[model samples]
Target chain A: MNTTGSTGLRPILERHESTLLANWITAQKAAPTYRPDLIKENELRDQCRDFLRALMQAVQSGSQNVDGSEWQPVRDLLASISRSRGKQGFSTTATATFIFSLKEPLFQLLQQEYANDPKVLAEQTWATSVLLDRLGLYVTEVYQQTRDSLIQRQQEEMLELSTPVVKLWEGVLALPLIGTLDSARSQTIMENLLQKIVESGSETAIIDITGVPTMDTLTAQHLLKTVAAARLMGADCIISGIRPQIAQTIVHLGVDLSGVTTKASMADAFILALKRTGFAITRPTAGR
Target chain B: MERIPIIRMSKFLLVSIQVDMHDRLALALQEDLTAKINETNARGVLIDISSLELVDSFIGRIIGTIASMARVLDAETVVVGMQPAVAITLVELGMSLPGVRTALTVERGMQILERAIGPTVTEGTDAGPEE
Candidate 1:
């Protein structure tokens, strides 16, 4: 209702809807973000048409701000586009460019329509630029949130897949670790090892850290905690795959590992465990 | 009127705790186990705690105390059949129950006791089939 110097874009957009859409599609196709492999040309045109229609409806409500309740449909449309583009492997800039690319075609149209009035032209062009910038920023924010959640999900999956308990022999269990040992990961590893120990009723467990890259004080403490827990369950834990560097690190950190049994390789630990469990491994005669 | 039973084997006393142990129950079991060890001159004590799904710091300490008591009475204590969750909890509580021997099951615990008691005592039992 506040029509003072309004120069609302809805009338111009409605009058030349076909021309605006044709020019906007051309502009989008020319932009660097346009991907032919991920999206078909028809799908891209449909998205552009939907976006223009939503923008016209929003502008008819007389609020240039994208955050206004009148722009809810437009916001929803951009949010969906951002999410899909993110899933399609579009970079943040590519997703945001979907909105920014409309600037050229609309600005050209605005110049042609308001050429007779320079003052009105300046105001309308500035308003249109600000509006488009806000929309572009909104799309970028949604895309970022989608990417963050995707990363979070991948991290959770990695944590689940990292620790695997393998039963090497009848009474011997091997847990091969493959990543940095954080507190959360340590908790999972401890629980998984303990559960396998109980289920198998194994007297010996070999924790192979060959795939683990670093050894810090906290990681050392977590390892000790896991060993202690396994011991408490009537199972012995043999920390194998101690690279020479890790051995030096452990000693320099002053972690008292004398109470724990450490082996240079899983084979040595397995042999020791077999010996303790009262089993002997002997090679048969060659010609017998 | 509630008491944990202590069964006498050949040279070992079996204490199978199948219920959620409270404070009084744990204390009573400790006293009863020590008295039984002293009375029977038992060589080993096998405690089956596989049924215990939960354990606090107090219960963990009680287990330690029981083992110490049995040791003082000339009986080696073997805690057996501990659930995985209970073991993790005990370790988290920082009470790994040091000086206590542990076995995965009651049969293994009995074997440990049989081995600890030497061949002289087990030679006679070896004549018959073990259940």
Candidate 2:
């Protein structure tokens, strides 16, 4: 609104100002029961827009005479805006605008004063790296927490899901898996299988996945890697219970599993493995 | 539980075959070739079946797939170092790798790949017969 001697770059500032007003109007219209008395949201759109315009003018002209102290007012305005909007409204668009508006001025100041200083450059780089690292850690922690909550809810829904391991002859373990084999579950399966193999001194592991819906290149590669890792520890991995659909998917995806021993079912895999180790299933037939 | 080794060279993808692959090697070959074609612009692929004792229809299908994929990607694909027993078994099963290049050794396969990539030096350029 202070239009004295603000000539060049006025159009760009006017555009941004209009956009902010439009966005604020839309936000207010969308609210179920808008409160007029909320001082935080009442003047935020105009205040922030004005502050940004002033900051841009100061940066463009390289005028240090124009008070840089106006930045605190802008920062305070953003803090209040963030508090009023809450986390859900903190979109990338808003963050990007704020960062871009500040970055130009910051870069200009640094270039003017510390351009020749290697120590200052190093310090700035180190500080930026630390900030980025902390941001990454925060994002990862948030994702893990959300995933854990979701998994807990799912577990509660599927109360009868069994985690049982069927023990075969001579320390061999047979795991019958059903449903989809995602990367996370595959990792868990590998960890559990390795631990069981070591603890039971089992030389062979039969993984029955007859109930698996389909297969892709990634899943096939994961299975191959698991088998290879098992061989490294002197144990052989047998994949069994492959459904017809999974076989078709493997062919479709063009993944090669030529070196893996596969069987029709857990029983077949178990018998074959046992026979190789000189053992037989001596139990009598029930219906005969 | 047989172990399969996957080794990658400059322009070749090598997969080592084992005993259990006897039943599915054909299909595996076809699939692997198809993937290689789709994933890379490499000139060739070599399947080393020296350790394999037998070959079957499944393996034959895989090899065919690889060849088909290679053709699509505008690259040449080859199967090399097939053991005598495995070759005989494949012949007995009435299976053949259609449109696929076959080589007797890994060295021969590399040569094929190099040739497919075109002459490394200019056709007319020479070192003047070692002076």
Candidate 3:
């Protein structure tokens, strides 16, 4: 009932809570970013209702500062919503629109409350805009954090997935490398290859690079470094799977791969490895 | 300075570095190994460094120096049992220890030595029939 402009938004929100909720839902439903496919209408309605209730409770403490402790529940609600939306594959615009869309219905309420006083209406509208903007930005921050963690987890998984050292025969180990070899990934590959070599006490290691798409000088250098490390560990390393283009690139770049024995395919490398390890495989006779 | 013992095996000299070597000790070992190789007329020298976890550029260079010195003395040197970390560190340090042979274990080192210089010669008293 106190319609004075000196009072903050709490009174206005309290007097027209239902009307504001209804109008806010209408505004959100009509928002361009609203995703009916991603979120059910009932679920969105529940989220809006809960957010409005938390906002009302927090504003009752007379603190317009969003960072104040009274706004803890509001922050928690927004963060949860943001994180959930992020996991649900909502775009940044769509997630941000959840908070920003409330501005339309809110400005209408402010206008009606200060119908005779344009100055008060303008002031309240600006304050509401700032408040909602801060909330929207907070939601984006949480959503970005979720996305970053998701990316970090995927990178770790990819690193684990890419490098696999297999023991093809006794005294022979095979390391099949896939994907682009960056410094970090090459470090991992070297460490993994060396560890397996030590564990198996293998005499020969075949490094198959068939899955590797391109062979730049850097990749070749990393390959040479790994071979050198393995050799220092008393394991002779052989590089295999030199596609014609990669071979031409190495020759064009004037990289010295003479020290490393290479084969055109992994099968040839495996046969040579078996020979070095003094193993012979003979095919079975036609019938047992 | 405590001298690293150079044990004379059949046709090879074996040096196992058990403790961390100081600069003086490494120098002493280097002199002792070369002298021992000369005195024994050994065909090969096997240095076991499995227990050595940490190696700096100095030790790496010393090993390289020993291998080169042995090669000059008409003897093959096989550095054996180098750990993976030591190998990576050596590679990173750009010391590949070229011209020196390497093996996974002392057994393999002996095999390499045997393959390079033939098997140990038997004394006249215990000569056995050839297979």
Candidate 4:
């Protein structure tokens, strides 16, 4: 208010907050992204009001940068709204319309206030457009960040869920691995298996690769590395679940698993592991 | 000029490496270990590497060389108590240490020796089978 060149957008918004909000809502509701199923009318009104109040405070401070401290509350509010809207299956365009719609009402007020001064009107209109564009882009950016984090978290969970080390007997542990054995997943598998072996003090570990999709050269190396590590830890490793195709792959690839024990099925591996651990399993001759 | 100590425990010479060995020291120790095997006419060798925290390819080859050398000299060699990190590094470095027998502890190594070479041959040794 002290400067003549100042836009005075703050006072104008404060005076006609309801009228501007009504107009903004009409613009949003008429758009193709108008989703009554996802967001209720009352909730939209509350968000509009909160954003208006924060923007008024921010503009009053005479700071041009959106990154300034005065705009923090507005940013926080929009980030939350963007994340929730993204989660609710709102399109990026729909979420952005929430910020862009306010420009209509805002431009009208600025035009009416600066009617006589063409220079002031043009300047205020350009400033409002720039500010609104930044805010709209911020919403989409926050939405994408939220989506990315959710995806990363799910990948980690999948890694942990896939590699589960189970105790087969008193001193024997078995790791039935599924899916492709990449470097990251191999690390998870190794760490989990090693920790389980230490905790159980198991002398024998059987790795069943039945669920593994294919046997590439890299995957074969990872398997051999796991076997060598387990041997170094004083636990001999046996690999099972060698399908005919996989067996052919290993032989065709000329992978040297010479000293290590491998079997065609989990049962064969289990029988061998039990015998090595000095356990005798007798089959029931008669059915109960 | 510090040297790694090689102690004779009955028929098996025990070398517990408690310090990080540089290239020269490791080569020197390899030479000393093979010499001790000949001097004592030991039947088995046990090298405990639990205290060894890091091992490059050079040190890995040395350990492999010593094991094969002992085997050629009519003695069995067992590397015991290798830390997990060192083992992983060795594998990743593409040195599998073939023909090297590994055990979790020195006690396990001794048991493996007795089982492999028979207790009868180790008749009067102080550290053989019994207490």
Top candidate on DockQ is 3
- Candidates sorted on DockQ, descending: 3, 1, 4, 2
TM-score on alpha carbons, each prediction:
0.85, 0.33, 0.91, 0.88
Clashes in predicted model 1: 0
- What ordering of candidates by lDDT runs from best to worst? 3, 1, 4, 2
lDDT of each: 0.87, 0.56, 0.88, 0.86
Q: How well is candidate 2 docked (DockQ)?
A: 0.01
Using TM-score as the measure, name the better of candidate 1 and candidate 3: 3
**Over the stretch B1-131, how does candidate 4's per-residue lDDT look in tens digits?**
88999998777888999999799999999899999999999889999998998999999999999999999988898888877788888888988787888877777788888777774543564454443
lDDT of 4 by residue, A160-267 (tens): 899999999977899999999999999779878866775677878999999998998989989999898878767789999989999999999999889789998999
Residue A203, candidate 2: how far off, in angstroms?
Answer: 0.9
lDDT of 1 by residue, B1-131 (tens): 69999998767788999889999999999889888998998889999999999999999999999998888888888999888889889888898888989998888887877777675545554542142
Candidate 2 wrongly placed segments (more than 4 Å): A1-165, A283-288, B1-131
- The residue-by-residue lDDT of candidate 3 on B12-78, one tens digit each, is 7999999887788888989999999899998899999998898989999999999999999989999
lDDT of 4 at B54: 95
Chain A vs. true chain A, TM-score per model, equals: 0.82, 0.45, 0.91, 0.85
lDDT of 1 at A157: 98
DockQ, in order, for the candidates? Answer: 0.66, 0.01, 0.75, 0.54
lDDT over C-alpha atoms for residue A14 of model 4: 75
**Runs in model 3 with CA error above 4 Å?**
A1-7, A117-123, A286-288, B119-131
